[model samples]
Target: MTAVMAPSSSADDMPRPRLLERIGIPRALAWGFLGVLVFMVGDGVESGYLSPYLLEEGVSKERIALLFSVYGATASVAAWFSGALSDLWGPRRVMMLGLALWVVFQTVFLVFALPTVDFPLLLLGYGLRGFGYPLFAYGFLIWVTAVTPRRRLGSAVGWFWFAFTGGLPTLGSLLAGLAVPRAGAYATLWLALGLVVTGGAIALLLVREPTGRARLAPAGERPVATLLGSLAIIWRRPRVGTGALVRAINTTPQFGFLVFLPVFFTDTLGFALSEWLQLLSAMFATNIFFNLIFGVVGDRFGWQRTIAWFGGVGCAVTTLLLYYGTTAAGDNYALAMVLVSLFGATLAGYVPLSALLPSLAPDHKGQALSALNLGAGASTFLGPALVGLLLGPLGVRGVMWTFAVLYLASAVMTVFLRLPDSAATAAHPATDHPATGAPATDHPAA
Candidate 1:
């Protein structure tokens, strides 16, 4: 759940620039961004590095896929509860618990579990990984929203996600690769543990504990019922999956698919896994570089429209390519991977949506983002399951086509979405919303 801006004291009593113009962004955001590092380390060490290690250790591909699924499946349940718990006990406490769990998982992976362990037992232990994800993710989300001025909320949230997803698979890839190749998988676990412990320590020092009723009670924003209810209303509309919500879910498909992509390329495209990984890594490296580059573009242009346009166009081209490019003479492995990266990049939309939801539901940012997380988490799990099921029936071509259909649908729905009448949209045209300033008539004026 995204918690962009925690409710704060009125300007008359508070020391800051009325909350809106405050200046602690660097200090406050450092903690929030660190949250990304913690989560990514946990994910990277386990998902990024461990899967390959386990494969080397003799786990079957099907089992590995199930292992991956278990992580998301467990996280889906854990995060649902984390939302209510974060709302109740405060995200800080919940987050610390998650980090503590991370310590357990990393330590357990190294000292106790052996290659002789039964596959089922290993899966159960891997499922424990989910318990850590929600708490840290929520911590980062809330912390980012709490500190960022509304004006910069879009860029800030985008940057937050940039670190969270990009950290593990991209930046940390080198470390994981180096550790495993040099010292073995067990050593990699120890090193990842070190990075996370450092991050967790930072979390404790940097992030303030969310206090009793952080939301403004007098303004009627603090009610737990409102938080839950707003989410209920949004989901009931039948349109949320089409909105920024879909883009969030889309992040996982590209990622989850990549975990199995070697199997796809080798089995379907007739390349060795080594050759496929080389191609895949090159593509992923490109994807990671473009995230920073395009992120700047989003800041300069409108985050919302850029996300829509890029995702839509990217989805369209990728869909056509997947349908026929793999069939043609060139095949263009690099091009295919670039589109895959684009499929992933469109996810930058979540940032503006993160900031925008709070602007849309000024009183209920946490709830909205919680609902958003639920959809995203659900899609992450569903994507792999769908792939597993469909790959046998539809075959590899069918699976690619399915992604095409889903993304194209995403593009169509994007056109009709109305921005919640927000100060962000109204205050600036080119600076705020490049393509979708959406004429003054569509959304209610803030």
Candidate 2:
């Protein structure tokens, strides 16, 4: 009798393409990201001057900060469950709910709160609006992880940040600059509301539900773990915890730095509004390229080292150079722009983290990714609060130097991050650790 041979499964059997091919990210998914970009640009139109608008409307600066604090806090808490809910109920249903809630809150803010300049109503409306974007955006992130192949996960995540960073506070600011001058903040916000509804609808239409992953049963049973219980994976894994920390560290400087950097450049430094805007554009453009570049690098070189050196140490050095270089360069605006652009480019090192965190928790990606967003949301509140407290006493240079130290601390933290044994085993089957079980090779985070 002839001996029967079983079919062999091997990495060689799987084709790995050039990172530039963008294989892991499907085309329709990219379009959905573009829809997200549209929604953000509208929402972000206020990024440049919301405080000034509020102050002009007679609200105290302290009150405005409190409003923002509430918004950030609410968003952070919402983010904690958005991913888990996506995992449990499916991304499509949760995202639709988020969009509907955003429309309702935004309309209320524009109609009732804006007309009367109602502080309490503003708090309620904006606070509810906070729940809108993270669910839509992070829910899509979970969708991305589910559909993309493991090999191209980093590149896909890079594109996610590309949409995220490129739209908000960058493109959004540019659009705001134009609109606030001609249309006024009130009308401009209406335009933003329209975009949120339209873009979210487009995303819903374009993106499809994932079929491959296991989901919580629709009717027969509750999940084995409660929503809170599901998050235990994060505490159990060192890599996941480090990822959350790194995400918080990566974003903290941006919020804190932006809080003062714009005014300092235009007012204190005596640069023209147009000149400062141009410099910002250049810096963010550099950031966009590096986001994609580092994603590819992470795939070839290794994600952890890429984040530790490029993200942690690179951010530390570049941040210092940006602050001190501007101070030392003085009247040399061109040189200052160069240093700032370099700072933005170095931030790309953290882009790979979207991919790395999910890889660390194959069995609990929804929970892991939610933790990542939780840290990000917390940073938005914490970073600015820290800068606000220190700004009076420390001054710009001193406060900025403190920001550099935070980056260094993040770098130090990265040393403890290690890929989960399951991921390692998937990569090299012969080296399987006894602790690892089923291989989780695809998932998402932001």
Candidate 3:
């Protein structure tokens, strides 16, 4: 199919803005990036040590696994809805609702559940709080895609993931490493609550992007229809569903790794909790950097090729290396760090899929994004569920192998996510809009 190109001046002839454009930050949504980074850091403060912390609080490993699985399930649902709701209610409104849910439920989890070690309360509160970040974060993502020129969408989304992951596991782990030792885990949790609120306030108040404040869908589109369309698009565009599956496999192991890797590194391998947190931070620090690198690479090298080979195949190889190589490294922290860093970098290889997926159904961008977000949320659930189920029978090595196999499968599935030849050509930088220098409005699939 021939993609339609919007008429515009050449981007090359247009005067480029300063550092933000150079660094791949969409100038229109800069505040949103800062907001997501801080907000996610608050959310992710517990990621490095939360499982072990629960065990110390008298929660069984089985229950901890269950808690995370439930949390993931809720997150998945919320992630899907974030897109659909964005279409109906506007991104800003959806973000507000998400922030409110997070604050209220998080307070319940901390004040009522954690203090008493009430398992039921813990599940209810934390699981429900899972709705918060995706709405706030992915809602902003829709905003980014709407305003960013098509030629730069990959880089813009890359910056989004860079901020999102950077805050969550990177700086978040680093913050935890310092805070847990100083203030204790419970107090550190309270600190996270404060950070989240502060970040949310900044984004809502400071960001002035007009598109996010109004519905992206047509004016007459009914809310129910928008919601239903989000689901129906999966079948109407089968490639989108395939892309969702690939997106799910992209991060299944990352979430699973959090469930067990801490214990493995600390208990089995003789590392301190702080050391492990440091390792986690270092690993994702590498990831945030490569998020930018791969964003640019995908724009130049072809998004599908980048995702298939670098994201899917490279991750498959690195997932195995991260497990076996680290094991073989014994007490060699330096070597282990290198292996883990490589794994983290490969994870960023899938960043382009965020740009690629929505382009598949531009006329239904919100619905298309819902499919992508569904996969994202499912991975959170699937990863931990896999660990909870397989860790008993298959053990860590077997679980690692399972993830590797899934990555390989994702690489193969990416073969089916091809774009039309003309659409692909339109997306190339050289053929971008002559006036604004933006790429064609009708984006290629995959």
Candidate 4:
């Protein structure tokens, strides 16, 4: 479908002011996305090997899991407020805060926790770091939403996730694979810490303060509502609420399934570590391509329809096939790799929901975007928690099937997504409200 770019300003209209106009939109967004990527890469460097390292250092498996759970929980709360804070303080200020916290907490972890392997310090340090990337990366996301035109929102959000996923767990894990063997885990961690600080500083310096039409709300009109109330208000919106659920389940496979995938591949299917890593690389490589492709597809087909058919249903089918290929097909690595890639590609459909949420609540883009991120943070904890709990009783096969069903359920939930009247009519004015052959009358002022 043809994308309608931002509304053009006529010569009679005042020219909208811009931040970093010298470099223009492309350069500004590139620097912003790169900043997010570097931070995520730093976060992800530990994804594949962190648990094992803890175990090697004499930390119990249960304690390691507990650390993740705590980090996720902390991140969920941080994710919610981060958006609202961005709206209040402006993205530039909020992002700087997040980056500062990242550096401080990471430094603590490297010094106190890494050397002694102290669990308490690790808990505090890592939990604080959890607040870092969400605020930093998602702060940029809010900046993007504010700046991007309504019609091209899908493309912008898609690219955001492209840089996001491209770094984390995918590229990060790849880096860790190399670094862990050569540099050792502590050194790799130090490297990641250095990168995060450097990336955050550079991105902040490059991005000018947003002004003009790019600003989300009036300078003095910040909402006075409680954070919980703000979140509740966004959740009450039909499209935004449904989008949240869709977002939560959309990443279940990544957080949940991937938790068990490597173990199953190496232990059950008898694949080598490098081979499983290769499979993961292939999946993310395909995901990077499809994320952009489906953004255009959503612009063409409608975002809701793309979510239902492509993301929800497609994830269900591919997940089931991938699981089956792993268990029933018995060591068919070739088939398994194809199914994994298909799963990754299908997931691209949900990327548009990021754009859709902000579009639904233009007036409160921060709250809507926060709701979107809350779903992501919730999935991080809940997906793995559920998998951990179910793995014992249901077995790996059973866990995969359950997540596939959840994907289907999330897709079905999309039926309830009704765009707000304003957004619905903006792009298609004729259908939502029509004029009658009566004299124009103004209602009494409310």
lDDT, candidates in the order shown: 0.55, 0.69, 0.85, 0.70
TM-score of each: 0.77, 0.85, 0.94, 0.85
The predicted structure with the larger lDDT, 1 or 2, is 2
lDDT of 4 by residue, 319-429 (tens): 888877777776677887887789879978898788677656654566778898888777777766776788879988888889889999998998876564546445322
Q: After superposition, how far is residue 171 of candidate 2 from its true place, in Å?
A: 1.3
Q: What is the lDDT of residue 103 in candidate 2?
A: 85
Error of 3 at 227 (Å): 0.7
Candidate 2's C-alpha runs over 4 A off are: 1-23, 209-226, 330-333, 420-422, 425-446
Question: In what order do the candidates fall by TM-score, top score first?
Answer: 3, 4, 2, 1
Error of 4 at 302 (Å): 0.8
On a 0 to 1 TM-score scale, where does candidate 2 land against the true structure?
0.85
TM-score (C-alpha) between model 4 and the true structure = 0.85
Q: Per-residue lDDT tens digits of candidate 3, residues 1-446?
A: 11222221222234755577666666656888898899999998989999999999999999999999999998999889988898877788998998999999999999999999999999999989999888998888877776666777789899999989998789999999999999999999999999999889888998876667877777787889888888888888998999999999998999999999999999888888888999999989999999999999998998899999999999999989988887887756888789889999999999989888876765566788899999998988999999999999998899999999999999899887776775566555555454323454544354
Q: Write the per-residue lDDT of candidate 2 for residues 1-446, one digit (tens) a residue.
A: 00011111221123543443344454436666787778777766666667657777998756776776777777776676666676667666767877887888989888999789999999989878888877877777766655555556677788777777776667777776777779888998898888888889788886553321234323443554536643665677766877787888887777676566766776677776556656766677688778888988988778878988998889889988887778776646789789878988888898877777766666566667777877777777766777667877898888878888888888888776667555643532332121121233322221
**Candidate 4 backbone clash number:** 1
Pitting candidate 1 against candidate 3, the one with the higher TM-score is 3
Rate residue 290 of model 3 by lDDT.
94
| TM-score-better candidate, 1 vs 4 | 4
How many angstroms is residue 43 displaced in model 1 relative to the true structure, after the best TM-score fit? 2.0
